[model samples]
Target: MFTEKGTLPDGIEYDGTLHSGYEIREQLVGDAISVFDDADVTARAVKNPQYLSVCVLANMLVSLGSIPKDKITGDLLMSMSQDNFNELRAAEERLDAKRKSFRAENKK
Candidate 1:
């Protein structure tokens, strides 16, 4: 189950079919690597939860082995409500704060 909001919901039927989170994640990883040409950039991008999220959803439609005749676009994500986007930004900020504090303490 997704711990965060704004992800495609699980446990509900889509076109009379459903997929497990494990399968979805596996596909997400595969699709992500294929989408990005540079492995290093893809690796770094995946580390950011927000960016990874975008990858997750972007892959969802095609993850189950369906080919996309049209290019998979991020227009849907870009149209997300401001509140949800803000929440994502806030979460990243919290993670950044924790990382900064941890670094400062370890440098002593």
Candidate 2:
């Protein structure tokens, strides 16, 4: 299901399976400002705000269908800066554009 070409950062390991779309429907469909606002609050309330933020971002990324859940780990995620996440989102957008183009061409 994951056809992307990037690898996890070194020294990170994750053995989780890809999450189904159903698992993160709330994140996907919920209002972006609200979800993140909630995450921000939750992070501020917790002793480990940074860790919580990473989890929140990872879940959001998964919900967006940008990356498979299995491919993500806390360590791998921590290594990624916000710019890296943005890059990942951009890559997903490009892939989606290609898929749409291919589908439209073939449908005719």
Candidate 3:
């Protein structure tokens, strides 16, 4: 399972057990707004069949290609809460602020 806070670039390394040459992926990710928008447009086209008549299938940029009508159930994802993201950002800020000191100071 992935962590809610593991939404950083380079956060994922290789999954040693699963595959060979570094099976890395973004641990957690943001919503695909474009995908959502395309799905919506396709949904509308589907509802009003007359609309498709105008385009004559000229534009699939919205869908990026053919969309599987049956597979789309309109399920979307949750965005990170401002409070939680801010907290993580603050923690990162604090760590960065102390980075120079941490690196320069001699460990006794």
lDDT ranking, high to low: 2, 1, 3
User: Between candidates 2 and 3, which one is better according to lDDT?
Assistant: 2
Q: Point out the worst 10-residue segment of candidate 2 by lDDT.
A: 18-27
Q: Give candidate 2's error at residue 108 in angstroms.
A: 3.0
Better of 2 and 3 by TM-score: 2
Q: Rate the local accuracy (lDDT) of all candidates.
A: 0.43, 0.45, 0.31
For all candidates, the clash counts are 0, 0, 0
Kindly list the per-residue Cα lDDT of model 2 for residues 4-108, writing each as its tens digit: 334322223234333222122123334233334555545543767566545554554443223445555444566555655555555456556666777888895
Candidates in order, TM-scores: namely 0.35, 0.37, 0.25
Tens-place lDDT per residue, model 1, 30-73, is 65555466566477566776665664445544332232323332
Error of 3 at 13 (Å): 23
Error of 3 at 68 (Å): 29
Q: Which residue pairs in candidate 2 collide? A: none
Of 1 and 2, the candidate ahead on lDDT is 2
Best by lDDT: 2
TM-score between candidate 3 and the true structure: 0.25
Q: Please tell me which model should have the higher TM-score, number 1 or number 3.
A: 1
